[model samples]
Target chain A: MNENNSNTNLSSVVSNRAWRQSAPWIAGAAMAAFGLSRRSKSGLALAAAGGALAYAGWRANTSESDQFLARGSVLLNCSPQEAYQRYRNFEDLPKFMFHLESVTKIGERQYRWVALGPVGIPIQWDAEIVDERENEFISWRSLPGSELTAAGSVRFEKAPSGRGTILTAITHFDHPAGKLGYAVAKLFGKVPNFVMQQDLRRFKALIEAGEIATTEGQPHGPRSLKAAALKLADPDRPLARSAPMSEILKQQRRTA
Target chain B: MKAVCWMGTNKMSVENVPDPKILNPRDAIVRITSTCICGSDLHLYNGLIPTMEQGDIMGHEFMGEVVETGSAVQPEKLKVGDRVVVPFTIACGRCFFCQQKLWSCCENSNPNYWIAEKMMGYSPSGLFGYTHMMGGYAGGQAQYARVPFADVGPLKIPQGIPDDKVVFLSDIFPTGYFGAVNCDIKRGDTVAIWGCGPVGQFAIRSAFMLGAERVIAIDRFSYRLEMAEQGGAETINYEEVDDVVQTLKDMTANVGPDSCMDAVGMEAHGDNPMYALDRVKQAFKLETDRPIVLRQCIQACRKGGTVSVPGVYSGFADTIPMGAFMNKGLTMKTGQTHMMNFMQPLLQRIEKGEIDPSFVISHRMPIDSAPQMYKTFRDKQDRCTKVVLDPWATATAA
Candidate 1:
C-alpha cells in the first residue's frame, strides 16, 4: 500500500476544485509579499515568475485536460499465459489490490466496478471491454454518463531470454479537480504510476513468493528523534499492527 | 530475559525484557551464547548514526543455538540445537538483490522502505539491532534474539570449534576478507591500510592472505599498531610521522602503494587544519562525517590504483579531494560485507588454523557489564582491542 496522506482539507470534488483555483493566487501573493520586502532585481524576477505561474494555474483550473495518462510495468515470475489467465479473472483482483472493492460482470464484455474513493466513499462506474487479445493485451473504457471517465489497457509479453513475463499497464483519466488534482496527488505520493508499481509488486509477490513479507506491527522508522528515544526505552511494547505469531504465520500459509 | 538497551548517547543498561519469539514465518529464535561489542556500536554509542531508539537492544556480532524455528524455515536446512553464527545483515534470499549475491542490498528485508528510500535513494537489507532505518529487529545482545530470513543468513558451525574461534565470522573476519577482495589484489601488490582497529587488523592479515607483497598499517594507538605488526603488516604511528602521505610516498619510492584501504571510517582523527575544520563543521551539524583518512587515502594511493573502504560512513562526508581522485583515475570499491558469500570460506580458513581471528580479543565480560566495557572499548582503555560478552556469565567475573 502507498499509505500516502493528503495535506488538503477539502474532500469533495467541488471544494477541491475551488481550492485548486485559488492556490495559484495564494502562491502569487506570498511571492509578491516577499518580493516587495526584498525590493531587488531578483525579487522582481521571482514575483514575475510567480505571476506567470498563477495565471497558468488559473487557466488549468478552468477546464480538465483531454486526458492524463499513467503507465507502469513489472516483471513477474509467472509465464505470460499464466499471468494473462490470472488477470482475465477480474473478480480475483480485490484479493491482491487493497483499493479495489469488486468487479462484477454485468453483461458480455461489460462490467460494474465499486471502488473506494480518496476517503471511504464508494465510487461506482460501469465499463465495457474495448479490445482484448488473449495472453497479449486487454483494453477497456468507462461508458458514457458514468461517475468517472477513464480508459485502461494492459499488455503482456515474454521477457528477453525467457526470464519471465512482463506486465505493463496504462491508465487515462480526466479528474474533476482538473490538473491541480494531479499536482496534489503527486505531492501526497498518490501518483498513479507509483500506485501501479506497488500494486504490480504485490501481484508479483503473490504469484512468485506466495506471500508478501511485512513488518507491520514491528519497529519501523521513527517520526522524530524523541519518538526514537522513547522506542529505545521499551521497544518490546507493540506499536500499531501487533498480532500473534501464530496468526501471522497462518496468514503467510494462506497465501502460500 | 536480560537484554542490553541503548538509553541515550553513551548510555546503555541491561534490563529485564521479554524474550524474543518468532514474529515472521522465516524467523527463528537463537539463544545467544556469545555476543560481542563491535567497533561500530561505538558509533551508535557516540550518537553519530541517526534513527536509534532509547530501548533498542544493541549487539550485532553474535553466535548461539537455534532453540526454535518458524514454519517457513526448512527443517532440513535449520533446526533446533544447531550451533550457528548469524550474520548482521538480514536478507530475504528471494529478493533480486539477494539472488545477485548483494545480500546487504536485499529489497524484501528492510520494513522501513519509505524512510530508507527517502534517505538512501533505495533501501538496503534490514540489519539486526542497528537502527530503525535498518528494520530495528531486536539485536542478539540479549539472552535471546529473533532471527529473520533464517534459511539464508545463519551459518551452522561444527560442534568442536569454540564460539570464540568462529564468532568473528559473523562480521569482522568476513568484512576484512571482503575489503581485501574489493581491492582486487593481484599477487605481490603493495597495500596500505588506514586504522589498525579490529577490522583493519583483519584487513592486514587478509591482504597478506591475498598475496599482497607488502602491507603498511597506520594508526595512532601503540597497541593496535603493535597488533597490526603481529598480523604481518608494517606499522606507521601517524602521531610520530611528520606527514603520512609524504612518508607513504617516501616509503613506496614516490609511486604510492598499489591499493589503499580506509578502515578508519567517519570518526577518523588527525591534527591537520582540514581535519580541524571538519571537526568544527561536524560538531555544528553542517557535515555528517569527517573524511580526513579517506582524503589521505585518495591522496596517498598510486595513480590508477584502487581504494577499497570497509569503513562505516553513515551520512554525507565533506572535504573529500574528488578532483584528485578523478584526475588520478582511481577506482573506489566499498559496500557492506555480503556475509553469506564469505562466512563459510572464512570458517574453513579458521578451521584449517591458517588464521586465528581471536587475536583481536582483549577483554571478555558478562553481558551485564556491556555498559562499562563499551566505555573501555571506546576509550581504548587497558589496551582493549575487542570485548566479547557471555550472556550467562556473572557481571563481576572477568
Candidate 2:
C-alpha cells in the first residue's frame, strides 16, 4: 500500500516524456515570473518554493502522458484451451519473448520477471495475474514501485470453421505515446509492437508445434562488431531494406 | 576447426573457429568430410538475400562422419562414428508439416520466423548457413559443425557407398529431383528448363528419370550445356539464340513444352535490355530479384502447363509476365526442396546404380581454396560445374 502511494507520487513527477526533458527550464521560467511579482525577500522565497511545488504538481498531473499502450495479435492454429494452458505458465515466456530473459512463478498468482530493457540492461520486477476468465482471458500488472511499471493482458478465442485460436496481447507501459519501442529498443533495434507480434508468433509456433523455434545458441562466425553496427544502423535506413546487391558486389571486389 | 566464413558480399574466408558441440537436444556434431559450395550460396555471395550478418559460416550442402550426438538423438536414428549426409533443411519430425512430408515447410525449424514471416508470410524450415531469415544456423562449411534436429534430417550412409556417391543428397541432387517432380510430368511430356548449372544438370537427368520425352536445357556456357547434353537433354545456348523463347516455341512446334522449369532464380543472366534493367534495378535496390529466367519460363510454357522453380528468390521481382501466366491458365509449383523427403529415395537410387550423383562434380578442392572456388563457381571458371570441398585437406593441395 505504501509502495502504491510512492508510485503515484513518482509517476506524477516522472510521467511526462516532455517533462522529463523540459521540466528544469519550465521550472526556471516560472521561478523568474514569480520573482518579479514578489516585493519582499522572505515572501519571495516562500512564494517561490510554494509556486514551484504547486506548478510541478499541476503540470505533472495535467500533462497528457503514461497512456503508452502496445498491442499485437496472431491467429494460432490450435485450440483456445491449449493456448491458454500454455501461455498461463509464465516460466515459458522466455521461450517466445526474445527480450524477456526469464519469468519465475513465485506464488499461485505471481511471477518474478527479468527482462532486458533498452540497451540490453537487465530489469527485473514482480507481477501478478490480476484477472482470469478461463480459456478466454488473463491479465497481469507489475507490482508497485518497480523500476519498470507495466500491465499486460491476453485473450484467447476460438475462430470459425475450426481454423484455430486467435491470441491477442496488450501491454501498457508508464511511458509516453511516442516511445512505442521504449523498453525493448536495444535488443530488437527498437521493438514493441513488432516484438509483441513476434512473441505471439512464437507462441503460435509453440502451440501448433511442440517447441519454440530458436537459433539463439547456435554457432556462427566471429561477428562481434558487425552485429552491433547493424543494430545501430537499422533504425536509420530510409527504406525497409539495406545494402543494394550490386553495390555490395562492387564494394566486396574493391575490398578483396 | 577450420570453416568457410562469409565475411561480406563475395568474400569467403577459411578461419580456424572452435569446433561445434551439440546445441539442441536433437543436435549432433558432424566432422565434415565433404561440403560443397551450392549455386544458391551464390545468391548469398551476391548479397541478394536478407538477414545475412557478417562472419556467418557459409555452406549448406555437406556430408560427414557423426562425431557426437545429443542426448535426444536416438541410437536407432544416429550414433557416433556414423557416416551421414545432413539435409540442408532442418525439420522437427513431430511438426504438422513434417508429418505430411512437407519437410521444408516444417514450422518448428526456423527460429527467426518473424523475419521471414515479414517477407514470405510464413517461414519455411530453417536452413544451414543460408541466412538469418532462414534460421541462420552455422553452416557445415566448417570441419566440425552442429546439426540440429539430427534424428529427423540426417541420413546414414553405408560403408560401401563412398562420400562422393551420396554426398549430393544433402541438397542439389534431391533439389534437382524436386524441381523435376514439380513439373508434374506426364510420361512422354517435353519439359524445358532454364540455367544448366549444377542443379540444372541434375534437373536434366531427373527430368529424363521421371520420364520426360525430351528435355530442353538453356544456358550460355558450353561446359554446362555439354553436361546437360550428357544428361540426355537437348541444349540451347540462350545467348547464341535470338529470342530464346521463340526458339523454344518453334522447337515445340509453336505449342511450347508441357512444363518449364527455372533452374535460375534471382541472379539470372540474359543478353538483353530487360536483363540489364534487372541488374540496374537490383543494384539500385529498386527490385530485389532479377527474374529474367522466370519471365522466359512463363512466356515459353504451353497453355495450362506448369512452371517449376527450384531456384532461390530472396525477395521481390519486377516485370513478371502475370498476363501470360494467368491468361494462359498456367500453374506454378516451387519451394525450397523438402530435402529429407527426397534424400533417402535419391540415396537408394544411387545405391541401385541408377544414378551416380558424383558425375556432377567438375572440381574437387581443399576448403582453404573456398574464396577462389566461390569466384571460380560464380564466374563458371575452368568450366566449373560443381566444386566439392574437403575440409580436412591442407593448404598445400591448392
Candidate 3:
C-alpha cells in the first residue's frame, strides 16, 4: 500500500503543472459527468489555486541570471563636507572594507583596488568614476582587465530633519561561470552584500564620529632636508628663498 | 600498516597502508594507542575546509607509546615504550618563531607554504594529518605515526592517570585553559561563552578553575547546555531566548559578559540560536571570528577589562571595529597555544583533582568505527559532545 501510494505521489508530482493549468474545465466536466464528492472537488480547487499562486511568487522572485540588488542607508549625524572629506581619500578604504588591502589612485578620476577574494583568491579591479557630484553622489564602473568587474554608486542626500545626511550604495556584479556561477552566487552572494552593507554603515559611523584631519602639515611623499627647510622658512612664499646651509646657520646663531 | 583515510564527508575508514619509515633524524615512530578526532576535524568532514586530498590520515589529538626512535634523536630522555601525548601543534623548537614561543608561525613547521603566503605568510604550525597546510604529517589515527620534533612536541604522559582521562590534556584541555587565560579573566569576573562544543565547554570549566565569578553558557544544544551547567556555568539556551545581548546585559546588571569566547569556529550553522549573523560578517575568517568574539566581549566587558582569545584563527582578512575597540579601552592578547607553556600548570591542576575535563567525553569507540562516530558528531546526533577513539581495540569491540 505504501509503495502504491508513493508511486501515485510521484506520478502526480510529475503531472502537477499540467493538472493545475487545465484544472478549471476538467473539474467542471468531472462534476457534470460524475457526482464527485464536494469535499474532494473543493480540495482540488484549493490545491490548484495555491499552486498557481506559489508558481507566480517563485517566478517573481527568482531571476534567470545571477543578479542581486541590495540597498542600505545610513544617517551620518554630520555635514556632507565632513563625510566627503573622510571618504574621499583612498587610504581610508580599509576602515570600511575589511578585505581591501589598499586602494591606489591611478588618475584624478580612476583608482585601483586590491582585495582578498573568495576562497583565498587575490582579486584586483580598476575603476573610474563616471559620475561625481561633489558631496552629493559618486558612481563608478569597472575598467577593462579587472577581476569580477562590477558597477556601483554611492549617493548622499540631505535627511528630512536637516541634521544629517543619508548615504546609500547600490552594486551589481556578474558571476564567474554563467549558470553554475549564478547558482553559487545565489548560495553565497547574500554574504558579500551583507558584508558590504556593514562596511558602509561603519564608514558612516567613522565619518560622523570624528573631526576631519586636514591634509595641511602632513608629509607629502618624500622631501629633501633643504626643500623642507625652505618650505618651513617661508609658509606663504613658494620656496623662493635660497641660502647656503652654513650661512643660514651662522646668521641664526649670530641673531641668537 | 593501518592508516585512517577519508572516503568522503563524514566517512573515514582504516586501511592497511604502507608503513611509515623514519624519513629524518628528528622523526620518531610512535605506536599510537589513544587518538581522537578533533572539533576542527569536523570542518574536513563537512567539506567546509578546502584543499584536502583524499586518503589523508586523520587524527591530530593523540597519545602513544614510543615504539622506535630515530638515529639522531636523543634516546636518553625518551626511550622505547615511554608513553607520551603529542600536542596538536608541532614546532621545530629551534626556529626563529619557535624560540619566541610563536610555535604556530614557525618557518619550518608549516607544511602549506602557498596557504601560508595567502594568510599573510604566517605559517600554520605543523599539525598531524590536518592537511598540506598543516605539514601533512600522518596523524595518530592509525596504528603508527611518524612524529617530528618529538623532543619538543611530545610530553611524557605522567603516571597514575587513566589514558582516557589525560588524553584531552594534549589539545582540548590546554585549548580551553588557553581560552580562559586569553580572556584575562580575573578572580571575580563574569564570563559568557558562545557554543558549548568541546572547546567551549572546557573554556567554561577552565574559567571557573581560573576563578571566574560566573560563567554563562550559550548554545542551542540542550545536552551541551546541561554539560555546561554541570561544569558550573549558568546556561542560556539561545533558541528559547530572543534578545541574547539584551538578556545577557540584563543578567549582568547592564554590563555584558566581562569576557566572551566564541568556540564556534567559521563553519557556523544558521540554525544555531546564538548565531550572530552580524558578528559573523565582522569576523569572516575562521581565525578572525575568534577575535571577533573579543569585539563583543569588549562591548560586554566592564571598562578597563581585558579580553582573551584562545580560539584558533588564521587568514589575513578580518574586519573589526577598531574605533569601538579603542574607544572602549579594552586590552586583548591572543596567539597559538604554547601548549608546552600551559601544560605543567594544567597538569598540576589535574593532579590536584581540582579539575576533571575528562567528564566532557561522551563517546568512546575503536579506531575502525571512527567514520560513523564522525557523522554522529558532525550532525551533533545523540548530543555527542566529545568522542575518544581507542586505537588498540578490535573492530568487533568497537
Candidate 4:
C-alpha cells in the first residue's frame, strides 16, 4: 500500500510539472491564432512566443510518462454546498457532461462509466471514489486493470466576491491511443481544457438557466468553415444542429 | 420561401429556401413585411467580412408581424398578429451584461461564442443575420424569420405608424443615435462625420439633436451628401476636395472638430495611397479592413476629443496611427449599438414628429430584385442611398 501511494505521489508531481510547462503553450497557440486572424503586427510576436513555449513544453514532457492533467474552474450562481451536492451524485454527470453515455453506481463508492471514445466507439471504465470532503471536494480514480486509467477531482468553494461558488474540476487521464490520440483530439478541438471548459459551461447553464439553449434544427445563418467544406463532399446531405433530446425537451417545455 | 442568399463575394440571389421555424423556446416567427439593405450589408456584398458562408441570409434591419410565438414568449409582451420592430442585436436579458443595459455584450445569446471569443477577447451579443461568429441566427431579409430572445428584442409598433418610419429603429437610427451619443458632443461643438450614408445622415441629424453647432459630413457620393444636407448638415465632397483634413481644419478654425465620427466602417474610400494599399491587401486577404476613416477620424478630432465609430469592422485595420491617437489624448468608442437602450426614446422622437426617419429611403423594390439591387446600392447607382424590400411583392420584369 505504501509503495502504491508513493507511486501515485510521484506521478502527480510529474503531471503537475508537465502542466506547468504546457499551459503557456496552449494559451500562446490560442493567442497566435487570434493575432494572425486579426492581422495585427503583434501576431508575429505571438507566433514566436508560441513556438518557444511549445518547444519548452515538448522538452518538459519528454522526461515524463504519457499522462497529463487538465484543470478548469467556473463560477456558478449557486452555493458551494449545492455545487458539491450535484457533483457528488455520479448519476447526474451525464446530464451536463457531453459524450458521456452512462455512469452507474456498482457498489458502495464504486461506479462504472461508459463514454464515447475518440471515433464514436463505446469505452467503459470502473472507478472508485477514494476520498470525499462534504461540501468541498470529491476525488476518484479508475479501478486497476480497467479499460482506461484516469483520475479526477471536483472541488467547490465560495468565490472571492461572495457572489456565488467557484467549482474547479481537475482531470488526469492517459489518452487511449497514446500521444497520437491526444494530438488528434486537440486538432479536432476536443482538447482536454476545451472539453473541461465546455462541461463547466453546460453545468453552469444547467444549474442557472435550467437548460442549455441552442439554435440547432430551428434555423442557422451560415455553415462553419469545416461544415461548409464537408458539404462539398456530400452535396445533398442535410446539416443538423446536433442538439440532444434533453435540450430539445427542455426548450419544448419552456415554449409550451 | 424566397430568401436573399449570399452566393459568393459580390454575388447574391433571391432563392427559394426552407422557411424558418421556432428552434428555441424564446423564439418567435415573424412574417417580414419590410427589410432594408443596410450600409454594413454592403460589406458582406463586397466580401469584406470573413466567416460568410454561401446561402447565408442577409439583412439585419427589418420589421413585420409576429406570425407565431414560442411557448416561452410572454403573450402579453409579444403575440401573433402583433406588429413589431426587432432589434438587430439579439440579447438574452438575464446575462450580467444585459442587466447593466449593455445589450450588445450579452453572454448567453451567441451559440458560436467560441468562434467569436477566439477572434475577440470575449463575444458580444448575437446579431440577427450577421455572421457565424454572431450566433448565425437567420436574418430577417426573407418572407419569414425566427427571432430568438423575442421577448426581449421585439418592440411592438403602435397603430398609425407606417413600416418605413419605424423600421429604421431596428438598426441604423439607433446606431446613428448611439454614434452621436458616443461623441459626447457639447453645446456649440463641431462634429465631423465620415460617409454620408444612412448611418452618417442619421449621425449628422443626431449630432444636431445632441447640440452640435455644426456637422461637416464627408462622402464621395453627391446623392448621399444631398441626403446629409437634407438632414441639415454642411457637406464636404472628398472626391472634389484635395485635402479633407485641411478642409475640416479650415472649417473648424484649424482646431479640427471636437468629435469626429466614422460612419463608414470596413470599406472606406479615400484619395490617399493608403486606401490603395488596403484594397490590394484586402484583395489578397492580407488585411480585413480599410482603416482610412479611422485614421482620418483620429487625425481630424481635436486634441483630447472623442472618436465615435458606429462602423462595423470585422477584423484588424492596418496603419491606424496609434501614435497620433495616443499623443492627441483622444478617446475612442465603438461597438454594435445597444438598440434596446435607445429604441423607446427614438420611437418617441418619431412619434412626436421630431424627424421623419424614412427620408433616407431612396428605393423601394420587390425582394426579387434584391440581387441587382445589392450591386446598385454597393455601387451607389441610381441615386440610391438606402433600398427597402417588400418581401411579398411581385417584381416588375427588368
Candidate 5:
C-alpha cells in the first residue's frame, strides 16, 4: 500500500466515525471488497457509507454529522416591524436563544457571540449583519478565523388581512467537536433543532406576550440522591432561562 | 417542606424538599392546604403516560394560601396572604388562546413545547406536576408550590368557604362543567355518560342542572354507581349488563340518549374482547390509549347526536370505529378544561350551595400517606373514589 492511499483511508475513517463504527469488523469485509475490485478511491468511500451507525468501542474524534443546521419558523401576533426589530437586536437573544450565553454588540451591525463548548470551554465568534431590508429580511455570517463557522438569514412577512407576522430563521453552524455540544445540551434535553424551534417560540412569546414562560429553580423531592449519584441532568431541568453548559454544571455541583 | 415524589412506575414517596419560590415575574408561591389525587394521576401511577421521569413531583388539584407574589402580578389580580385555588393549566393571559378564553390551549406556558409539538402537532398549555412533555413544572402535591402565570390561572376564594368546598376548582369541577356544557343539553334532553369517577359524578349533576330529563351513568363499581345515583343519575353497572349498548338502546325506547359522554379516558376497564385487545396492545406500547369507552360511546349514541368527551386521551387510540362516527354525522366536542373560563362561575355555584363539589371526596389522608394512598387509589381499595391530602397533617393523624 502506498503512503498516500493509507493517509486517505485514515482521514475517511475519522471523518465518518458515526457510520464507520465497527471499523475492525468491517475493515476485513472492506479489504476483501478492495481486493476483488480494481483499485479505486470511490469504492472505499462507498463502503464507509454503507456501514452501520453502531458505536465503535474504540471511540475517538468527531464526525461532521454531529453539526447542526437549524431551520425553524413561528407565527407572532404582531406587526412585521415588531417581529423584525425583536429579532434584529442581538443583545436580547440570550433571553430566548437557548444555546447562546450572550451576544454583545461591539460595532455597528457587528456582534460577538459566546457559547458553551465541551467541558466548560467557551466557543466564540464575531459576526456582522451583511445586509438588511427594513421589516422584510436580514442576512448575516461569522467572521473569518472564528472558533465556529455560522451563517444565517431571517425573514419577516406580513400575513394577509393584518393577522400577524410570519418569522422564519435558517441557521447553520459547525462548532469544534460539535458532537460534544449536542451531547452536553441533550443531557439537559435540548437538541439543536429543538433549541432553535423553542428559541423561535420564545421569540414569539416575547414579542406578543411581554415575558417568556418558564419554571426555573422549582423544588422537587429526593433531589440530593439523584443529584449526587447519577448526576443526570434530570428531565425536569427547566428551560434555558439561565445560560447553558458550564453554568448548569456549576449549579449542579453546588447542589450536589 | 415535605413533597411527594414519583420514584418510578407505581412508586411514590414523601420526602423533604426546599420550599418553592417565585420563578417568574407573574409567579407566586402557594402554601398548599388541600391537594387531591385525581383519576388521571392513576395514568401516571400505572406508567401509562410517557415523559414522567423519576423524582418528578405529583398532584395537580390543589388550593392554597398565596404566601408571596412577584413584581409583575398586579394587586388587583393577586396578592400575598390571599386564599386562592390554583388551576392545573398554566396560561399567559396575553396569548391568543388565553384571550379567546381557551386557557388550556395557551401556547407560551409550556416550556417543553417542542416535545409536545412532536406528539400533538400543536402543543397545549403546560400542566403543573404532570410530565415533562407538559412543561415539567413541579406540581402542587407539596407543602409550598410555585405557580407560574399566577395572575391568570388562580381564583381568589372568599375567607368563609372551607378548603373542601373549593379545592376542586383546579380541575374536576371545571372539567365536568365543560363536559356538560359541551353536551348542549336542551330542555328535556337525555344524556348517557360513561364512567362514574369524580368527574363523571360532577358531569351527571351538571347534566341535570343543564336541564337533561334523564342521566344514565355507566361503571363497574357499585359504590361509584351509588354515588352517581345520589347525583340523580340512573345507574347501569356495566359488569352486570350483558350488552351495555343494547341495554341503553332498549331503555331509551329503541333510540339512544340525545347525548353521550366519555368521562373515562385512555385506560378503560371492561370484560369484552375489545377491552382485552386494547389491554394487550397497551401493555406492549403498540397503542397509547384504550378506546373501549370511546368506541362504546360512538356505537351507542343515537344517529346525528352529539358526543362530548371530557376524558384525557394522551396519544393514538386504535380501532376507534370511525366509520360509525362519520356515517352517523355526529358532532364531537372534547378538550382539556379551560380552567380560567369556568372557575369563577362555578365558585359562585358552590357558594350558593347549588351543588357541593366536596361530595366526591371519599378519602382524606395526610401527605405522607400519599405513597400508600397511590396504591389504594389505583387499586380502588377502601372504596376510595377520591382522596384529599392535607399537606400539614401529622403522620399519626388517622
Candidate 6:
C-alpha cells in the first residue's frame, strides 16, 4: 500500500507538472479569442507576451538542478581593499545587517549567524565562504537546518552612470515546495535584503561622504572621552547610550 | 476592493476600491472572508468619532485567509492557505508594547508608515479600519485587507469550532473575557455587567463561565436584555426600572455587586431621559460622559469590589470622584484586551463545546450589503444586534 501510494504521488506530481506547462497556452488561446470579440486583440497579445515573460523570469530566477548555485554583487564607492576590510570579516556583517543580532566567527571561513525569527524564535544559520576572490567577489553557502539553505554572491562593479561602484546581489536556493516556497521566500527575504541593501548604500555613503578610518591597526584600549563621544555618535553603535551618566558620576565620586 | 466607507454622519456606502497588498515585510495581505460592522464603527458612521476622513474603511471585527505575506513574516506559523481570526488591533511583536505583552499599543503597528504616530492617539497602536487617529489601516470590511504584524495580530483558527462561534473571540469575546478576568471574578461572586450590547452580552456570559454566581445585565433594549437572559444573566431593563443602581444594590443585598464591568466603552448612551440630550450633544461635540456607567459601576459595586473597563477611551479629560472611589476602597482595572494572552484559554473552552457565542449575531449578509446593515445596526432597527458581512458574496444583482 505504501509503494502504491508513493507511485500515485509520483504520478500525480508528473501529471501536475505536465498540466502546468500546458496551462498558459490554453489560457492564452482563450484570452486571444475573447480579446478579439472585445476589440482588445492587443490585450490578448500582451497577455500571451506577459505569460511568456513571467515564465522566463521564473526559470531564470530559480535553479533547475539544485547544485547550490548562488550569485550576488555589491557596489561601493571605496577601493577593493577598503571594501574587503568590512566584507571579509563575517562577524562584523551583523553590524550592517540589523536583523542579524550576532554572528560568531567559529573558523577561518565559517560563521554562525543568530537572527530574529518570527514568533520570538532565534533563527540560527551556519554559513561558510565557499568562494572568495581578493575584493571583487565573495560567495557563501548556508549550511543545512535553516528553513532555507541558500548560496549567494556579492560582486563589486563600476557604477554604470558614475564613478562609484555598483554592487549587485544574486542568489538561488532550492525552493522545495516550488511556487509556495518561492512566494514565502520572496515575502520574508525582502526585509533582510532591504536592510542589507540599505546598509550597502550607507556604506557607500560613508566612504564617499569622507569618513576617516581612525581605529585601523590601533591597539584596543580605553578610548579617550572625545574619541568615545565621537564613537558614540556613530549610527552603527548598538546602544543609543553606552553607559549611564549616574554610573560615570558615581565612579568619579568614588575616585575623588 | 469593495469597501464600506464612512462618507459622513449617517452616510456610508460599499464602493469599489484598490485592493490592499503587502507593502512591508512585516505585512500580510489577507482575503477577508468575514468582516462585521462594529458598534464603535457607528461612532464614525454618525461622525461622532473625531478626525475621520472621507472614504475611510470602517468595521474592524474580521477573519480571513492569508493570500500573501511579507518576507519577514513566518510562513510556517501562518501560510497562504491557513484561515485566521485577526484582532482589531495591529502590533509588531518586537516593539516596546509588544515585548510587555501590550500588543494593542505597539509602536510600529500602523499600516501607513507615514502616519504611524498620527494614525492612532498617543496610545500608538489599535485596530485596523478605524478612524485616522486609530491606525487608518483600511478596515477588514472589504474584499481584501493588508494586516500589519500578521504573526502577532492574526490568530490561527482552531479546528472544529464554527466561524460564527469563534468570531466574537476576535474582539468582543476577548474584550468581555478581559472584563471578567480584570474584575477578579472569584468563584460564586455576584457580577454586574453594564450595557447589554454584544460586548455586554458576552461579558455577562463570560462572568458566568468565570464562576460568577449571579450576573446582572443592565440595558434598555428588550431584545438585548433577552439575549443577556438567555446567556444566563438576570436582566434589568433600566427603562422599566426606577433606579438601576438601587435595583442592582437590592439584588446584591444592599452591598452592591461584588464586581462591575463597564462594557459600553466610549460611545455609551446615557440611560436617563434628561441626560439623553446632553449625551447626544456630547457625542456630537466628541465629548462623551460614557463614564456615567463607569461611575454607576463604582457606586453599584460593594466596598473592596473591582471594576473592569474594557471600553475604548482616548484623549482623556474627565474627572472621576477619586475620593469616593478611594473611600469605597475599590480596585479599578481597565485597559485594552490582551487578546493573545486569552486566546488559548478561550479556544480551549470553545473546543470543549462549553460556549456558543453566535447568539449575538442577528444578521448575516453579503459584504456589499454592509452599508444597509450598518444603517440598520446604527439605527438599532430590526433588532440588529450583530451583523456579520461575508465578502465572498457577489454584488447584489442590479
**Native contacts matched by each model:** 0.06, 0.43, 0.00, 0.25, 0.60, 0.00
- The local distance difference test score of each candidate is 0.76, 0.77, 0.63, 0.77, 0.78, 0.64
TM-score of chain A of 5: 0.60
Best by lDDT: 5
Instruction: Give the TM-score of chain B in candidate 6.
Output: 0.92
Predictions' DockQ, in order: 0.09, 0.22, 0.01, 0.16, 0.27, 0.01
- Shift of residue B52 alpha carbon in model 6, Å: 1.4
Q: Residue A224 in model 2: shift from native, Å? A: 7.7
Query: Candidate 3 or 4, higher TM-score?
Result: 4
Clashing pairs in 2: none
- Report the C-alpha lDDT of model 1 over A1-256, residue by residue, as the tens digit: 1112343432332223433445456545644543443356855775676567555644552345322334568787668998899888888877666567799999899888876554445656788887788999887778988766766777899998767799987655555463344332332222344456556766766565545555444422113365544345433222221112212112100010
lDDT digits (tens) for residues A31-117 of candidate 4: 354334334465466456555644564355333234344567887767898888878878988887765779999999999988754
Clash pairs, model 4 backbone: A255-B71
Docking class of 1: incorrect
TM-score of 3: 0.57
Per-residue lDDT of model 5, residues B1-398, tens digit only:
99899877788989898888876778899999999999998898888877776778998999999999988899899998899999999989876678789999998998777667767778999998888779888998899899988888899999999999999999999999999999989999889999999999999999998999999999999999999999989989989999999999989998898899999999999899989999999888788899899999999999988899999998889998899999998889999998888999999999899988889998899998998899998898999899999999997996
In the range B1-398, model 1's lDDT, one tens digit per residue, is 88888877898888878777677677888999999999999988987777676778888999999999999889888999999999999887765577779999876676555445656778788888887667766887888888888988999999999998999998998998899998888998999999998899999999999999999999999999999888888989999999999999999989999899999898889978988999888777676688889999999999999999999988779868999899999999999899999999999998899999888999889998999999999999999999999999986676
lDDT of 3 by residue, B1-398 (tens): 66677655566777777667665556678888788888888876764444444566788888888988866578866767888888888766754456667766554554343343443444556677775455556677878877776777788876678877778877888888888888787788998887788889889988888889999987888999988998889988866886566778989988776777767655544433234653454343333233334345556665666666665543322546677668878777666677877776777787898887688888888887888888899889987988888877887985
Reference A-B contact fraction recovered by candidate 1: 0.06
Clashes of 1: 4
Candidate 2 lDDT over A35-117, as tens digits, reads: 33334573367346644543554355423332233467887777899889999888888887766889988888988998765
Model 4: per-residue Cα lDDT at residue B266: 86
Please, what are the lDDT tens digits per residue for candidate 6 over residues B1-398?
Answer: 78887666787777777777666566678888788777777766765555455566777888878899878677776888788888887765654356678877654553222232332324456567775445456777888877766777778886666789877767888888888889899898999988888888878878888898999998888898898898889988877888888999788779889998888766665657635654655654534334667777877889999989976654332546677689999999987777887776787788787887788899989987877887899878999899998888875731
The weakest ten consecutive residues by lDDT in model 1 chain B span B110-119
Comparing 4 and 5 on TM-score, the stronger one: 5
Model 5 clashing residue pairs (backbone): B129-B139
- Residue pairs in steric clash, candidate 3? B182-B308, B183-B308, B287-B313, B287-B314
Off by over 4 Å in 4: A1-65, A75-92, A105-111, A118-120, A128-136, A160-165, A177-190, A207-213, A219-256
lDDT tens digits by residue: candidate 5, A103-189 = 999888889998654345566789988777899988777888766676677889998876688887766554345443443323221
Docking class of 4: incorrect
Q: Could you tell me the C-alpha RMSD of candidate 1 in Å?
A: 10.3
